[model samples]
Target: MVERGEPVRLCLHIGMPKTGTSLIQSVLQGLRPQLAHEGVWLPPNNLAAHRIAVEAFAADSRLSTRADVEAIREAITFEEAVAHSRPTSEEFTKVILSSEYFQQCSVPLLLPLLEKMGFSSEATSVVAALRRQDRILVSGFNQDVKAMHRSTPLIWDPDDAHQLDWYALLTPWAETFGKDAIKVQVFDREVAKKESLTCLFLEACDVSYDEASVTSLEVSRRDQENASLPADLLAFKFVANGVTRPGEVDWLIDEAQARGVGGGVYGLAEETVQAILEHYRMSNRQVALEYLGEDGDLFDDVVTAPTHTDLTVDPVILSSLLAICVAAQPRAEGARNHHLR
Candidate 1:
């Protein structure tokens, strides 16, 4: 239990997505009751409050249209009400909030929401798991391809500049919360040897673990919360996204999953991967030296060449995706006809 006079600590895990965030969130959510018993409070009302908070902040921007602002304001009001109603029990020593969207948020945008949520800058400890740039780009691209509203083709041109700039992303948080208040962990397999991402996150939250605790927190091997699609399936989905409605595309993805279409992670060209790594090399090194106090490279290994298999869509998978598009044609035609009328 928290001492009567001390302020509550907030463990804010702002994710750099594709760094096993979903897995961590799922495990934390599952272990909420246990955590509460141990004086760690996970928000009961909103399991994913940070995501909604970030979205609201984005929509509330002046650059957004009035309708968007109003809608987001309504959402913010609802979330604020929920947060206020939550128990302010003194038994709780810490609060845990995790969301990948928070990584995209600026200090001005994020700080206000944290204040509203009853977390002070002085008491909050921000944690971010950083992945290597080349790998992150591929994962981020796959995510975009899988998204409903994303329509642009994925490109790796030097001019296009990927947003996996760790230095820029971390600076605001570090400056606001103090360098020591922000903990940076490398999201690599070798780094997390013996312990899983779930375990590493729980450790960061100051949660103790025994054999029984480990057993209780372990997610099943079969469960894939936000697993990336195979190269072939990803390619098919990328092309199919252009023609099909979001709903149809979702069904197609489910069907592909049902058919066991996954092989391994999608790969980018070697030259493209090298170019991206070189782009962020200095920034990554700076982050490591300043935040982590490591003189060596931030990444466990450099991307000298492409690591995964080529992005070749299997013939059978391509045919299946084409069929999905064909099936959606009637609905598309009906919508077009209605618009004409």
Candidate 2:
């Protein structure tokens, strides 16, 4: 438990995406003021502050520019200002920073940046939520289609050493922060049945979700929080991406959603799913034993392999494709009209 007068503890929620990360961020951002009152600080200036901080430290040439530096500096200044404004009786006990992109950052680069932000390595804890590999891959593929607007699936090499290897992903942080400092929670049905992802996360951060916090969250709750594209919509988007200009994808997504054309799940054959899982089986065991302190399977349930063939288009998905084609016509006509004029 965090003591009120202790030096601020920084909690970094680095994500392995498709693990309810966006919802967690949305809830925290929405309840920032109430959380601050409770002495937990989720910086308001840039929700992606940690992402930018990681990029800036990794020296991504694009983010290393003066503008990026100033942006991070501004965020730091804002956090400090917020810290100072708290009532004299309470000092911030924890600072929560989240970013899914931090999963890509190396610990060597990430640690120095956290130190610069007033976090001591000893006082910081890294929290991550992980999903089964098969589910993660399918969800990642869907995210690429929806968020990245990719016409084709992202490159997948079954033999690739790093992709989807839970152990590899967690090892660096465990090595640096010590295995005890790293907390891993399985994102599965059993956990979901007991508590929400938001609540699970708050617990990990040592933040209390008292009656007031629950009421505030309920009041501001969105009907859809980081909802995924329905499989049919996802399939339609996949096909549309092949022909549409990159800049036009967002418009296409918005138009499709407006028409109420959605529903479909990306799937893999049982053999394929099992094979992929086997590839990471050993690493997952290590992670479970070493970091999670679990002797059994890392995930609570085995992924239910799909009976149907992968990426099979059924009647419903076909209908969604038709809707997308019809939706694109108006945009195409408008573009032609502008050209003629």
Best by lDDT: 1
Q: Flag regions of model 2 displaced more than 4 Å.
A: 1-6, 56-90, 154-156, 189-194, 215-224, 247-249, 305-341
User: Which candidate number maximizes TM-score?
Assistant: 1
List residue ranges in candidate 1 displaced over 4 A. 1-4, 45-48, 55-87, 159-162, 189-194, 211-216, 221-224, 262-265, 302-314, 319-341
lDDT (10s digit) by residue, model 2, range 89-181: 346677788877678666887777566555678888888888888778777887777766677664447767475788888888888888888
Q: Name the lDDT value of residue 221 in candidate 1.
A: 30
lDDT at 217, model 2: 72
How much lDDT does candidate 1 score?
Answer: 0.70
Question: Per-residue lDDT tens digits of candidate 1, residues 73-155?
Answer: 45556456445424468888888777765665567776776666666799888888998877877777777677543557567
Task: State in Å the error of residue 277, model 1.
Answer: 1.5
Q: Estimate every model's Cα lDDT from 0 to 1.
A: 0.70, 0.69
